[model samples]
Target chain A: MASIEITNARKSYGAVDVLHGIDLDIQDGEFIVLVGPSGCGKSTLLRMIAGLEEITSGDIAIGGNVVNDLDPKDRDIAMVFQSYALYPHMTVAQNMGYALTLRKTAREKVSAAIDNVAGILGLNALLQRRPKALSGGQRQRVAMGRAIVRQPQAFLFDEPLSNLDARLREQMRTEIRKLHRRLGATSVYVTHDQIEAMTMADRIVAMYDGIVQQVGTPLEIYDRPANIFVASFIGSPAMNFLSGTCQITAQGCALILDDGTSIPFLAPPNVSNGQKLTLGARPEHIDIVGNGSAPSVPATVDLIEPMGLSTLVHVTLAGKPVKIFTLARPDLAIDSTIEIAFNMDKTHIFDSETELRLPRANEPFAAETA
Target chain B: MSTPGKSRLRKTAYWGTHYLMIAAFVAFALFPLYWLLKVSVTPNDILYTEGVRMWPSRTTWDNYTFVLTQSHFPHYFMNSVIVSGFTALFTCIIAAVTGYAFSRFRFNGKIVIVALMLITQMFPLVMLIAPIFRILAPLGLTDSLTGLIIVYTAFNVPFATFLMQSFFDGIPKDLEEAAMIDGNTRFEAFRRIILPLTLPGIAATLGFVFTAAWSELLFALMLVSSESASTFPVGLLSFVSKFGVDFGQMMAAGVLALIPACAFFLLIQRYLVQGLTAGAVKG
Candidate 1:
């Protein structure tokens, strides 16, 4: 196991740049997930670490040794591809033992290593069958087994569970997390699925447009996103945003919407009076309350989606669509006015011009670290 | 209510025409081969007497006996085997490597090289026969089985390379990348993982080149003048002397010549039918 350091890493194809000088410090025995949308350079960063792609300008060190010029084989990293690229001609045992056999390990030792990995992956009965004979889920296990059998310095998984069905993907996600705990190996997993990153990562590095938006624990990023992009991209039924200008009064600071409605913050954020700012709130953080409630805004219900466990109520607030997730099955008619209240302590305030979150006076350093 | 019975009758009628057309094609293809066998077994004395007959009243193995023992057909058969065998082996090896490079790598002048190979196949062999003879004569390659193998290999490689390249393209590139990450070099991955999966393609190229070299007549007739270096096709022409054509013995030699190509096809038919790489990746 090792800590990987990527300093000022940049990748360009001719004149078109894909990665714009990314810097990351990964600790030993930590499971770091690089999560982003497609074409966001997450996979490129993972490939650079694995020595599969050449770095245009940067230094990447594994175990304090620079690996920028090493071949993938010499780098001593194992990767499980999204396609589960198992050799068609080789049986399950041979596929798992391929790396050790290439190192010219003793035949008995190779067999023993394969046996141990297969046992852990529940693949003992499939040792003699070729890849073509296995089902999709079984093939995914063999791909994982191939990486673990060698016990490399680190594991690189590039959307490895994307090919499986939903149930299988959920099962393998837990399995991968358990395996990481068991081996305590440094691992870098790349995926476009936010839920995967939230469930699997010890530290989630959310990226956009080839730049790291935020890097923190799952809850830390969820609670305090650094920018508008991170705030909107990190959650499902995403966080709602309302465009407005800040108004500082004798009582406290509040935001004035275009329609002349004022929504006050519990504690004023560091912002100038009459400054353009955006209010952000998660769907679950907002509540639908009875009429005549203080500090509430009236909204018209647009749509309601019941997901059995919870309900997503879509409403127009301050002339902007907002989604509110709640456990109560509110029997509200469409286009009917309902009063909604934002949980003031949990609401986020961002500068509209810079798209950077404004720090609250109570939590001075949260935005800086987020 | 009678629609079901009417549709069933229509289905039978549709299948009836399909089988009838297939039978016609089969008969058209095999009739000449059947005639060759029929003539080989007909006695030489009755060959002309039963003119235009499908089968003769009398049958004898004298033509086969005479061709095998009394003539130089055996030596010619051995010469053809040596030339075609070597040509197929050399052509497949060269085509495999060239095809792999064309499939995987991005070299500087790949398009120019491929265009040149295609240009070689565009011209008629008859136009280049004189120049080829002159070139080989100076190298002391004329009238030799080794010379015939060389020319046959050169003529067959361009097509065989294209054939092999298509096979390589059908395989996913992820398998090799996976192998490289598993500690094998690119070449080692090709050898261990890719080459085994390409057996069906190799078998196909081998069969194609073997049959092409086996039945080639123009170059064989022009390049080899000595009876010692003669291929079976040229040897069949030797039956037409100053006096007359020996149709019986010539037909017998033709029957013998079909054996190896048939056996070669039979050897590779198993691999041709197997889809070995079906489950290697997701569909």
Candidate 2:
């Protein structure tokens, strides 16, 4: 196991930059998941760490040694590609033991290592089979086994589970986590699927447009996102945003909507009156009330998607689409009017221009750090 | 399952189109070769008398016997084989290395190099034949089998490289990257992981270059003057005298020349059919 540090890393192809000065510190044995959208440079960063890509400008240190000038073989990092690039000519056992053989390890020791990894991944029976003979899940396990057999300084995975079917992806996701826990190897995984990052990582580094948006625990990113992008990108059905002006009422602060509705917010004292802000809340935090007895906004249901455990209600609010996840089977039909109330305590306020979280009452909006 | 009449009609219609198309193509391609054998077996005395006839009234192996024993057909056949064999071997080696480099690396001026190779293919071979002959004369390469091999390899390398490049391109880069991570260097990865998977491609390239070199006429005729160094295509023309053409013996030699090419393909047809990388990656 080894600690990795990426300092002010920058990647560029000619004049166009893909990664713009990224700085991250990964502790030994910590599972760090880099999550972002497509073309967000998460994979590029991981490849740079693995010595597959040259750094435009920056330093990457593995086990306290700088690896900027080192080749992939010298970097001592094993990567599981998205394509599961198994040697088509070699059987599963040969694929897994290839790295050790390159290192000129003894033949007996190489076989022993392959046996150990195969046992861990439950691939002993399929060791004699080629990559094409195995199912997708089995191939994925072989990819992982190939990486673990080397016992490299760090393991890098580049969307390795994206190719599998949904059910198999979930199963392999759990298997990867279990394998990580059992081996306690330092690892970096990149995926666009936020759910995978949330479920698998000890720490999640959210990225957008080649920049690190925020880094925190799963609950921290969910409970307190640093910006509108992280808030929307890290959740199912995403978060709802309402644009308005901060109004200081006599009792507490409130936001004055465009339609002249005042929704009170438990805001910090430093927030000046009449400041423009965007209020953010997750779908699950908002409750749909039946009648006018509670404070609510009138919305017509656009569509309802029943997910067995919960129903996703798509409704229009302030002339914009908003999705709310409700556990109750609301007797609301299509095009029917309903009242929705925000849990003010869970509401997030962002400065509209900067997209940074605004201070709410005595609650420091600084994101949770591990 | 009970509708036997409809099923039989459908089966017959499907097979009718399939077999009709196949039979038409087979007859179109094989008719000339069959005629070659027929004319080769016909005696020279009855050749004019049996003019334009599909089959001769009588057949004899006199043309074959005279060409094999009396003419320089065997020496020319040996020279053609040596030149074509060497050209195919050298061209495939150069192409594999250059093709793999083009497929895998991102070195400086890679696109320019590839563009230059493509440009080499655009020029007509006829225009360069005189210049090649002139260049080879001063070097004492003219009238030599080595000169023909060199010319054939130069003419065929660009196309063979592109052919090998496509095969190399079909292989995923991840496989080699995996090999590297497993402990082999890039070259070792190419040899162990990628080369085995590319047998079908290699066989195809060899067959293509071999046939191309075997039938090449322009360079062979221009470069070699000796009867011994002339290829079979050039040798096929020798039966033509000032008075009339020896169609019977020429066709006989032509029929004999195809035996080696056909046998070569038969030997490599297995490797050509087997997808060596079938179980290597996802479909």
Candidate 3:
């Protein structure tokens, strides 16, 4: 196992820059997921760590040694590509043992290593079959098997489970995490899927536009996103934002909306009165209550999506779209007015000009550390 | 298909017409080759008498024997094989590397290089015949099989490289990246992973260059003046004397000339049909 250290890693193509300066330290035996949207340079960062791509202006050290000048082979890392990229001509056993075979390991030793990995991946039945003969889920397992057999310094996954179906992707997501636990190998996985990052990583590194948005535990990032981009990008049904200006009057603090509507919330000390900012609330964090004891705002319910256990209710609050996740199957008609209250404790505030999350009163250091 | 309203009889008639048209085209293309085979077995005494007939009443092996033993056809055949074989070999090696570079790398002046290669194919070989002969004459390359090999390889490479490049483009870039991470160098990845996957493309390029060099007459006739270095196509013209044309001998030689090309295709047709890179990436 190895700890990867990347300092001021920058990637550019000619005059166009792809990755701005990025600094990250992946500890030994930690699963770090670099998650972002498309064109966000997550994969480029992973590729740079694997020595598949060169760092334009930075140092990347693997296992305490700088590998910026090394070839991918010399880097002693294994990668599972999103496409699987299994050699079509080689059988499952051969594919898994390819790295060891290249190292000129003994034939019996390579076979034993492949056998060990195949057993862990439930690929014993597929040992003699070629990649073309395997189904998509099977091929995904083989790709994973290919990486684990070598027991390299670390593993690099480039959206490795994206090609599978939903059920298979979920299953493999859990399986990969279990495998990582069993192996205790340092791994850097890159994916555009927020859920994958949330479920898989020991530390989630959320990135946007080639810059690291935040690096923290999954719940830390979820509870306190560093910026508006991180807040919106890390959640499903995404966090809803309301455009408003912070208003601190005698009767507690509230936000004055663009359309003359005001929603009440306790303002942080840093957000001064009449400062233009944005309010963020997750779908599950917004609730509908009858008594209206909490800071409540009247919203027009636009759409409702029932997802078996939970319901996603889309509402328009202060003339902005907002989603509320609730267990109660509220039989509400479209365009019906409903009183929704922000959880207040889970409510997030962002400066409109900076598009950065503003810290709450309870968490004084969230603004600096998030 | 049992799709909605489509009837079985209509589908049968549609497929029947499809096969009929295909059969018609096949016959149209193969009739000359059939005639070549038929004339090779026809005796010389009855060649003119049965000129219009598809098959002669009497058949003999005299034309085949005369062309194979009495004439200089064997010597010309060997020269054609050597030239075409070497040309195909050299062209494939050069095209594979160049095509791989074109497909995988983004280098300075790549577009200019590709445009220049394309431009090389724009002009007809006939226009450059004089210049090519002049360049080869002083270099002691003319009137030799080496001259024809070089000329054929040069003419065939650009198109062949384009062919190989398309095949390389079909393979996903991840395979090589994965191979590199699998402890293989970039060149080893190309050699071990990329090259094996490109067998079908190499087979196709080989067949193209071989047939092109085998049947090429313009450069072969112009570049070589000696009988020792003459190709089969040039030797085919020897049958055309000032008197009457030797139809039986020429047809017999033509039939023999197709054997290697046919045998070559037979050896490589498996690769052309295999589609080996099917599961190299996503299904």
**Is candidate 2 or 3 superior in lDDT?**
3
What TM-score does candidate 2 get on C-alpha atoms? 0.95
Candidate with maximal DockQ = 3
TM-score of 1: 0.91
After TM-score superposition, the amount by which residue A77's alpha carbon in candidate 2 deviates from its true location, in angstroms, is 1.4
lDDT of 3 by residue, A101-208 (tens): 889999999999988888888999999999999999999999998998888999999999898889989999999999999999999999999999999999999988
Which portions of model 1 show Cα errors greater than 4 Å?
Answer: A242-276, A294-300, A316-321, A335-337, A367-370, B1-17, B51-54, B241-244
Best TM-score among the predictions, by candidate number = 3
Q: Identify the CAPRI category of the predicted complex in candidate 1.
A: medium
**Per-residue lDDT of B119-161 in model 1, one digit per residue for the tens?**
9999999999999999999999999998999999999999999
After aligning candidate 1 to the native by TM-score, how far in Å is the CA of A217 from where it should be?
1.4
lDDT of 3 at A363: 85
What tens-digit string does per-residue lDDT give for candidate 2 at A1-370? 8999999999999999999999999999999999999999999999899777899999999999999988788888999999889887789998898888878899999999999888888998999998888888888889899999999999999999998899999999998999899989999999999999999999999999899999998988988888889998999879999889988867877888888767777785567888999999899988898687456778889999999899999998867788898898877889988888888889889988888887565665578431
Indicate the fraction of true inter-chain contacts that candidate 2 also forms.
0.69
Please give the range of 10 consecutive residues that has the lowest summed lDDT in model 1 chain A.
Answer: A361-370
lDDT of 2: 0.89
Off by over 4 Å in 2: A368-370, B1-11, B51-58
DockQ of each: 0.67, 0.68, 0.88
Model 1 C-alpha lDDT per residue in residues A1-370, reported as the tens digit of each score: 8899999999998898999989999999999999988999999999999887899999999989999998889988899999998998889999999999999999999999999999999999999999989999999999999999999999999999999999999999999999999999999999988889999999999888888888998887888898898889888989999989888889988889999989888544457888998999999999999988888999999999999999999999878999999999999999999999999989998889989887677873573242
